[model samples]
Target: MSTATAEPAGRPEGAEDAQGAERAEGAEGTGPIRFGVVGTGWRSEFFARLARGLPDRLELAGVVTRSAERAARVRREWGVPAFLSVAELLAAEPEFVIPSVPWEVTPEVTGELVAAGVPVLAETPPAPDAAGLRALWEQVGASGLVQVAEQYPLMPGHAARIALVREGVIGTPTSVQVSSTHMYHAVSLIRHTLGVGFEPVTVTARAFTAPLADPLSPKGWSDDLTPKDARTTLALLDFGGGRSALYDFTDNQWWNPLRSRRMVIRGSLGEIVDETVVRMADPRTPYETPLVRRRTGLDLNLEGSEVRHITFDGRVVWRNDHTGAHFSEDDLAVVELLCRTGAWARGAAPEPYPLAQGCQDHLIALAVEESARTGEAVATGDEPWSA
Candidate 1:
């Protein structure tokens, strides 16, 4: 294996200048944590963009893409070395490698990296299906070098809610209603807020078809002016012990403006619906408050329209650690995962998200799909990783 150092050749086009780069890189005084990526796909670019945004905390050491044309594009666009193999990428000595390839390819690449004794932060799902998940778990589940990049719980809004729930502000959470993202992402959020571990869940789901305007998607706004039939799947997850979750998802909900992202966490003493918190302060008194966000650059105060922190009951529940980075809420979560993975890889912090958690999340998600199709309830039993 090649052990040659792969360093940045020069600053890429549109990158910040020397003084600005230095200022951002030196902000934390520990230098940027260098990491490598093993794919150059669309999802991988999110990592590259976040590294550029949060220069003080992250640095892209190299990228591995099989296609020479894509590799050249990555080198030109990212201003980082592009290699053809994991061995070459590891030669750069990145603290960890993010396998952001396709779902089917993720487990194989992750196994390769783990076998090489390098820490890895794998993309979501980790495998394509249940069998794939089991096989992948059998391969690298006990390596203790794998962390999945599950960023949903790390988002500022969700993080704040989770903090409140953990602090007994909501008593013991009994159920959660998630209408935001879908599949494993939705499952991750539900499991996280309810604080449920590998407990077996009985999922009852069904699909409904309805007409809705399809204006927006991940690509962009569609010019076709027509209302199309959209699929909406709703499921009830029973975690036993009187804990449950209601999973609701509509097609294109992530980008469609008509369907807003929503969540509800119900506890013994109170419940949280989106940004509003309603709880019983005492035996007969009820309290209500909005989780206000300190966003800058609204009218005249020019801090540049970024989220500063989230507050509840006059106390800060979630603070933007990358305040000056000008990142969106989703970007904030991704960048936080990258930094936390880097810290764990270097033994400076605990594992951010373990592979077993991802496996369980996906397993439950698959059951959701199955129950929706078969029109019957599905139960997920213990898996190898569930232990």
Candidate 2:
């Protein structure tokens, strides 16, 4: 992987250098980048925090919400103006606008922003289905003002894992196993680690009801107890080059309070078993001795004993601690990169994970769903994984 050093200390918040700062300020030194946000919901809080933490790099110019009450609340909370209409938001001339609305509402709102040539950092899964995502992609491709806000791969722990993989610590990563109850979450991780290049070679799935009630279901949405409602899907993803990944997802796991999401990667040299515990067992040495351990918020260690163990604080592992909440240090590393590179803005060229990458992941997910429904092997095209 290419190595790029982060901007040194004393550099302006969003600029790479003095000249970049001048350009960012204005054509000849104007001001900071102004951001308008759409949707006032749980998701918006992440952006709110980012804006708050980096005032010079990101400024929350205004916000748009459907209800006046919610808009007023967000305005008071963030100390920024709020608008009920997209036109009102566009009039503010924000350099970028982040839409945190649901899939159903994203298309229309994104279209409005693209139509006005306003840059956008829209939330995922960009649309409800592939067609809608394609339409949004086309519009953004033509208008040059959209960047999908899929934050999963950039979330701290995952980002750290990606870095470790790139560093060859695992040695020729040949396969990965990911388990999560939510299909979307599982797919996001798969895509992040394997990239868009992974192809679904086979799928085996079974559905069963656990006879448990779902608290999140609305009154009318809970009518049926079909197996599909509580199911498990296992897929074999072939990335070619003898590399493969096994994906396991189970809705029933959600009902089990003790269950937790887990990901394991296997390679020729060693393996990373879990984010909470970093375990490396060299093939040459005994698995018991000379183990390496690195937990979150601690230094890495090379131990002489077999089966070295490292325990991370429950709060740090859960991502609920204030210091480790929402994003990790690794995640902040990527965010800092985005701020410095200005990749979050509309019309910017594609970065490591481009807009098309999201579309590809969606299509692969659709293929997985199809394979599971038909109980047959599904082969994907080369386009999905191509950068």
Q: Which candidate should be chosen as best, given TM-score against the real structure? A: 1
What is candidate 2's local distance difference test score? Answer: 0.56
In terms of lDDT, the best-performing candidate is 1
Model 2 CA deviation exceeding 4 Å by range: 1-33, 53-57, 142-144, 195-205, 211-229, 252-256, 276-283, 286-352, 382-387
C-alpha lDDT score of every prediction, in listed order? 0.84, 0.56
lDDT of 1: 0.84
lDDT (tens digit, per residue) of candidate 2 on 294-377: 334334543321211222322221121122233444335434434433533422322333345555566666667777888777
lDDT of 1 by residue, 346-368 (tens): 56555678888888899999999
Candidate 1 least-lDDT 10 residues: 1-10
Residue 331 of model 2 has an lDDT of 39
Clashes of each: 0, 9
RMSD of each: 9.2, 8.6
